[model samples]
Target: MNTYRKTFKFDAEFPFEYKYRDATSAQFELPNHVHDWYEFVYIYSGRGTFFIDHSFYDAEAGDIYLIPGNTIHHSYPVEDDPKRATAFYFSAAFVHDTSSVGEPFHYLQPFETAQSKQSFRFTVPEAYRNQIVDLIEQIHHEYSEEKVGYRQVIRMHIQHILLLLNRHAEETWGESLLRHQAAALPQWIEQTLSYIDSHLEEELGLAIFARNSAVTPAHFSRVFKRLTGMNVTEYVTAKRVMRAKEMLRLNDRNIAQIAEACGFGSIPHFHRKFKALTGMTPAQYKHSL
Candidate 1:
C-alpha cells in the first residue's frame, strides 16, 4: 500500500501555488484525498470524470471545479484522451487577508458557502474560458519566474479571475438556475444533502430521498441529476465513502465498525468500494493518516 499522504503548509514564505500541465495521452491516477488549501482546477482540454465528495461530473474542456479545503476528490484522464488542466491552490486566510486590504470582500462567498451543489463543476463560455486560461497562464508564469512584485501581480490576477467568474456565473446561471434555486431548488438540494449527511445510518432508499426533495420518485430522480450531476445511488455511495474516510482517520474503531457506521451493509462490500474509490483499503488509509 502506498500509504504516503500529501499535505501542504501556507506560511509567509509561500502563500499559494499554481501548476499548468499538458497531460496529453497519459493515464494519471490521483486517488481520493483531501488537501488543506482551497483548490481551483480549470480544464483547458480533453475530457474525464471528476469525483468530488458525493458527486461525479463529466469533466471536459472549459469546465472549472472548485474544491474547498479538506474535501476529498480525484479526477483523471478518460482512457487515452488525456486531461490537461491548470490548478490554483491557496488558503482561505490568504484570500481574506489580501482582500481585507481595500479589495472587495465578497470574493470568498462562493468558496465559503460551497454547499454540496456549489462545490463541483461549472462550464464556462468559450470567450470567458479563453480569458481565464490567459490569466491562469500569467499567474503560472509569475510564480515560476518570481520577478519583481510577482506576488502582488499574482494576487491581483487571482482576484481578477474570481471577480470575472462571479460575474459570469451571475449572468449565465444565476439569473435562471440560481433564481430558481433561491426560490426552492437550492434549498431542496441543501436539505437533501443535509438529510443524507445526518441519516447515514438509515436505509436511504429512492422513495425516501424523493420525498425529502418534495417530488415524485421519477421527477426527483430527473431533477437531482440535472442539479447535482450524480444519481442518488452514486451520491449516497460517495457520501458513505467520505464518512468512512473520516472515521478511518479520526477514530480507533475497527474496519467493520466503521463500515457499519458508514452504511455499508457488509465488511467485504465496504472494503471493495473503499479501495475502488480511494485506491486503498481502510487499513491502508488509516495507516497513511
Candidate 2:
C-alpha cells in the first residue's frame, strides 16, 4: 500500500472548507493519507469503518471523528449499509485567530487529546446530536448561499460546533461515549516514531533504527512498512521535509542552513526531496508564502 500526503488549497482570507457526502455520491471513500488541516467527520446516517493512525473503529450514525493534521487515516462505508457524512476542514491558524488571550477553554482540546491518545472516535449524547447536526447544517447553509457576511456566519457556527464538542468532552470525561481502541502498532514501533521525531536533525538510517530496536534490519523494515505504509527512508525523508517547511515559514533561515538543520546531506539533495514531496522547490515554497 502506498500512503501519500493529501494537499488542499484553502482561501487565504477564510481557510475553512466543507463537504457533504451521501450514498449516491460517486466517490464517498477515503484512501489512506495524511494532510495538513484539522478535520471533523460527522456521520449523518448509515455505518462504516474508520482507520486512523494505529487503530480502527466502527463508525455509525451520530458518530463524530476528530482528525488532527498530519495523522494518517482512511474511511470506507460498509458494504450492506453505506454511510452519509459531512466533513469540516480548517487550518490551525483559523482556530488560533478565533481564540482570545487568557481564555480558559481551548478550541482544539478534543482533537489534540484524541490525537495524543490515539482515540479519534466519539459520539455526543442523544439529546445533543440534533444540535450538532443543526450547527453543521447552518454552516453548510452559510457556505452554500455565500450571501453578505456569510464567511463570518460560517466562522461563528464553526466555533459554536467546536465549543459544543469541547463541553461534551468535559461533561463526560471518562464516559464510554469516547471510544478508544487498542493501539495496533507494537510498543517498539511507537517508541521508534517518537525517537525519530525528537532526533530529526541527527543521522538516521534503517540500520541504526533496527539495531536500536534490537532486531535485524530486514525484519524491522518489513514490520515498519507494514504498519506505516511507508518504508523507513521514505518516512524519515518526509518528516525532514515537513520540518524544513515549518522553518521556512516561521524563520529567516536560508535554504542551505535549513537543509543542514533538517538532516539533508546537501542543498541539491534537499531540493530534490522537498520538491518530490511538496511539488515545489524550497525557494518557490517560501516565495509563495
Candidate 3:
C-alpha cells in the first residue's frame, strides 16, 4: 500500500495539483520566473494579458494557457477590466516520463510564442473550453464545501477535468477523440497513488492492484497505459524513481536507503533507471541539482 501524500504551502507547491480563482486587479502585477512544476491558467471571466516565454497574448474568458515547468512566464490584468481565472500546476513527470510521446495536454500553449519563440500552442474548442470552465468552477465549489474525504473527491474531479484537457490535446493534433474514446484511466489511479506514497516500500504488483483499483487485469492495463503513457509496471518504476529523487535531494536518507525506501527491487535497477531518465546518475544529479 504505497500512499503518496505530501502537503505544500500555497505559495510553494509543485507536482502541485489544485484549482484556484483570482480576482482581477487594476494594476499590472506579475513576476517573471519559472516554478519547479507545470502550470495551467484558465481564464474564466477575465480581460488580461499574459507574458509567456517572453511573448504576449490576450487572455480572455475561456482561454487556458499551459505553462511548462521551468518555462519563464508571468501575467498582468487588462487595464481596468474585471477578471476571474483559475489555475492548476504539476510537473511533466507528474504526467508522464521523458520517453512518453504524444502531446496530450500540449494544446494550451500561448500561440503568440510560435512565430517569435517557435513554441507550439493550440486553442481549446469553445464548446470544450466551456466544459472545462464549468468543471473547475464545480471543483472549486466542492473544495469550499469540504465534504467527506474532500481531498480524494477533488482529486477525482481534477482527474476528470484532466480527461477533458486530454481530449483537447488530441483535438489539437487534428485527431478527433471522444471522452469515452480518450482511453479509460483507472478509477483508483489517484487512490492507489495515495496509498503508494504512504507505503512506498511495500511490495506491490498488478495482481493485487487489479482488485485494488476494481478492474480486471486486461482493462486496467489498457486504460492505465493509455492515460499514463506507460504500462503498470513502468508506471511503478517511474513513481519509485520520482520518490527516490525527492528523497535523495530533500531527506537525510543516503543512496542505498533511499533506493530501498522508494521500493526499487535492487540498487542497480534504481541507478539504471535514474541514469536513463536523467543524463546523469542519481548521485551526480543530486550534487548538480
Candidate 4:
C-alpha cells in the first residue's frame, strides 16, 4: 500500500488509552504512519530501531519516545526476543480541556521541545525510572478497573506524568534548550515557509529565499536541509505540489491554471513533480477524489 497519512478520530467517551504490549520482531513492525493524537512509548524491555521521520534511534529498555501528532514514525525490533512496551495515546483536545484545573505547560514542555530540533527519545534516568514506571502502572490499573470517574482519573495521572517528563526534560536538557532553539535553524525558515504558502503564484527563487532569510545561498541551503530534512528547492516543490493538490479538488481551475497558480513555470514540470511525489498524476488524483 502507498504510505499515506493516517488521521485518528478519538472516541468522545474515552479520548485516551494506554496498554502494555508484548510482541516479536515481526509483529513490532508498523507502517509509516501519522496520527492526530500524541503517542508516548516506554520501552520496558527489548531492543529495536525506532524510525521517526528521517531519523532512527537504537532503542532499548527504559527508553522513551514522545511523538507528537502528525509526525510519521514506526518501530522494528532487531532481535527475536519479545519487545515489550507500554503506549499512551491522548488527544490535543484532552490536554486543552484539562488545562483549566492545572498547568498543562508544566507537562507539555518535552512535547513542545520535540517540535523543535531537540531529540524526542531519551532514556529515563535511574533516579526517576521507578517513579515513571509506577505512574504507567497506575494508569494501566485505572484503565483495567473501569472505576467511577476513571477517565478523569486517567487524565489526572497523565497530567502528573507530563509534569514529571517536563521536569526531567529541564534537568536533562538544561540551558541547551535555548541553544538548540537558537541553533536549530535560521528563524527565517519558518517565515519563509509561511511566505511561500502565501505567494505560491509569485516568483520564488533560491536567491530570493536566501535574501529573505538574511543569509548566503550556500549557508541557507545547508541549514535548511539540516533542520527541515529537505533542501530549499525540494521544500518549495513539495509545498507547491501540496497546493496544487488542494486546488485541484477545491477549485474548478483546469490543470494549466493550477500549474500556474502553484507557481509552476510549466504544466509539464508540475505534472512530473506532482506524480513523483504523490504517486499519481494530478488528473488522476483529482478524479480519484
Better of 2 and 3 by lDDT: 2
Residue 135 in model 3: shift from native, Å?
Answer: 1.4
**TM-scores for every predicted model:** 0.60, 0.72, 0.47, 0.60
Encode model 2's per-residue lDDT on 19-98: one tens digit a residue.
87656332545456777789998987887667676566777788889998766677756767788888989987776654
Candidate 1 lDDT: 0.70
Model 3, total clashes = 10
Q: After superposition, how far is residue 102 of candidate 3 from its true place, in Å?
A: 15
Best by TM-score: 2
Question: Deviation in angstroms for 69 in model 3?
Answer: 1.1
What is candidate 3's lDDT per residue for 131-219, written digit by digit as tens?
Answer: 77777877787778978876555555555665676665545653332111111324476566457556768787777677988889887
Cα deviation at 87, candidate 3, in Å, is 1.4
Question: Considering summed lDDT, which 10 consecutive residues are worst modelled in model 1?
Answer: 175-184
Clashing pairs in 4: none
Model 2, global lDDT = 0.80
Off by over 4 Å in 4: 4-10, 97-106, 175-289
| Per-residue lDDT of model 4, residues 1-289, tens digit only | 2234444456786678665765546443555555546888888786866656435566768777888864656666756665688888887667654445654454556777776654667555676678878888888888899899878888888877777777876776644322221233345876776587689889887899999888899988887665554566766676677678768878999999999988999978998988876778999988976
lDDT value for candidate 4? 0.70
Compare candidates 3 and 4 on lDDT and give the better one. Answer: 4
